[model samples]
Target: MTESETVRLGARIRAYRTMRRLTVRGLAGLAGASPSFVSQLERGRTSASVGMLRRISGALGITVADLFNEDDGAGHRVVRRLERPELPAGPGTRKYLISQRPLQNLEVYAGEFEPGASTGGEPYSHGDSQEILLVLRGRVTVWLGPPAEAVANTLAPGDSVEYRTSIPHRVVNDGDGTAEVLWVVSPPTPL
Candidate 1:
């Protein structure tokens, strides 16, 4: 990396660390680095090798590429359709990670569910996030809270729903064909 790139990377690291409210020592512990080393990296006094950058980004719950792909404009970038990272979304379902890293407080994903497929298995919760589900195609039945609560809502194409994610939630696609939906979350907790 050039000297300018190193400094820019350091600034990005500092920004993310501060956003997560982690002390330099805490981040160092997570990244398996000495606090002094972290300090030097943050001050642009040293350049982190690729392996070191990988460990640090992993500690921050971000991919190593995210460390170098900082958006140049007001945090905006157009994500190409085929470039999204695919993630598991239970049986017969596929999810695409839509937002690049350093997403600030936002996380976005697109999910495609086959008939009877769902974001099931174990219902999950995110303590620091709230989510908006926008159905782009097909239909879904979203269960709020635990399965026992039975609080549910069925959403069709063009419909959207917002919910706090502090309680466990899951969604099922019982429609005839594949279901596609976009999820937008605040204070992004990864999928």
Candidate 2:
């Protein structure tokens, strides 16, 4: 892979890894690789083969296409609109369009949250699903369970987080500036 492609792949790997809430060591073990290998792959220092990527994707319960999809202008793509049926969680938030319509068995959105905003504060569940969140700006706190795994991790423009939808998870904007996230959910909700 070229430098740019390597970087993109690394970003995707990191995104999926975070989405699954798997540590480097954990993913490496699951993928039959070493921790250093996973770390290097996530940093773009190494390139992953199709086999490796397949294993990783399988472990994450996602299809290979999910890791390599480009924006193809499918369904109804929206820009900055706030009148749609936005998921009820987090005040002072907006969800822009990343996909045209919520078809194709998947959905993606550009989420913007003002400072001190949050999502799904009342402990909700979404059946059996998964969510991937890439932090495009500022910092946010993620709570992932009733036990409440407080992820105070700060994400810069290129950081991300992913987790199973079976467990209740919520996000809160904890930075001084607004937080922007690219959120992708699989198995489109019946809305």
Candidate 3:
């Protein structure tokens, strides 16, 4: 491969390794290679032979062709507005999935909430991950914790909050108009 192609290939390998939650040493052990070699390959400081790539790809539980997919696992991609998929949501609410499918370490959603619309009747949890909710327009209330003693924060445009997804949470539109927001989450949760 050319130098640029080699760099991109290294990036794909690194992305796949991370998605599989494998350490460099762990992957090297599985691939029958040295940890230093894997590290060098991932950092674009060195190139791997076809055989080495095969071993690495096998260790990652993917075919060599998958490594060359256009998605590049975690590389640059663009999702046009028209291509965003609509998601099933609670009453008076609409959500668009802004992140690409076969999700990587992160996922995003664009939400539109009509007056009094809420995520659910009660708080909900999403495994163990980090999440950020950013209000883009109108006003909304975010509730975190059990229903009995939930903490509610009313947010306006430009406001954002970060929290752990393990905590039960819900969001509601508090204004008379529609509320627009973005939800950014890491280590994506299943839809």
Candidate 4:
């Protein structure tokens, strides 16, 4: 891998590891490699074989594509004219993407929620990854974990939170006004 590619891959690996709260030793054991090897991989000091990459992806619960995709720079020029696929989660929720395709290190999205809007499903857990949410407008109530710990966080604008995704989590708009959040998912989520 080139230096840039290695750096991007390393960033993705590190993001996933932190999201999962997995130590180098833990991931190394899961990948059947040494801690040193895992560290080298995360630092981009060494390249992993196809088999090894697959093993690592499997251990991380993500696809190989999620780890190697390149940024196309499609929707970053201007804020108003960015064409992004609006993923329909449920009624009253809208999702806008800052990228048309998934990149190696980060996934950016603009999300809007109507009053009483919710993620509209059971709390879901991704692979080894962390999520950051920045509320641009209104207030939102986020619940984390299968036990559903109510997060008493309310954001009017320019407020954000980053958390591990290993536990189940959901976001809801419990206030009267619509909520807008800029969400970034690290290590990318498989399309």
Query: Candidate 1, residue 158: CA error in Å?
Result: 2.9
Question: TM-scores of the models, in the given order?
Answer: 0.70, 0.51, 0.65, 0.59
Report model 2's TM-score to 2 decimal places.
0.51
lDDT of each residue in 1-191, candidate 4, tens digit only: 79879878977877776655578998788778899998988988888898998888777656678678554445564546346777767899998877544343577888889999978667767755778888889888777767446454566678787877666778889889999888888766544
Candidate 4 ranges with C-alpha deviation above 4 Å: 1-82, 148-150
- For candidate 3, lDDT tens digit of each residue in 102-191? 566788999999999999788999655689999999999999888888899989999998888889999999899999999998876533
Kindly give the stretch of ten consecutive residues in candidate 3 with the minimal lDDT sum.
68-77
For candidate 1, give the lDDT: 0.83
Number of the predicted model whose lDDT against the real structure is largest:
3
For model 1, what is the alpha-carbon lDDT of residue 41?
94
Alpha-carbon lDDT, every model: 0.83, 0.71, 0.85, 0.76
Error of 2 at 121 (Å): 2.8
Which tens-of-lDDT digit does each residue in 13-115 have in candidate 2? 7776765556899879888999999999889999888999888777665666766765544556555555445554456877665654413456777788898
Taking the tens digit of each residue's C-alpha lDDT, what string does model 1 give over 22-74?
Answer: 67998899889999999989988899888899888876667887788777538
lDDT: worst 10-residue window of model 2:
96-105
Candidate no. 3 TM-score: 0.65
Cα deviation at 76, candidate 1, in Å, is 5.4
Model 3 has an lDDT value of: 0.85
Number of clashes recorded per candidate:
0, 8, 0, 0
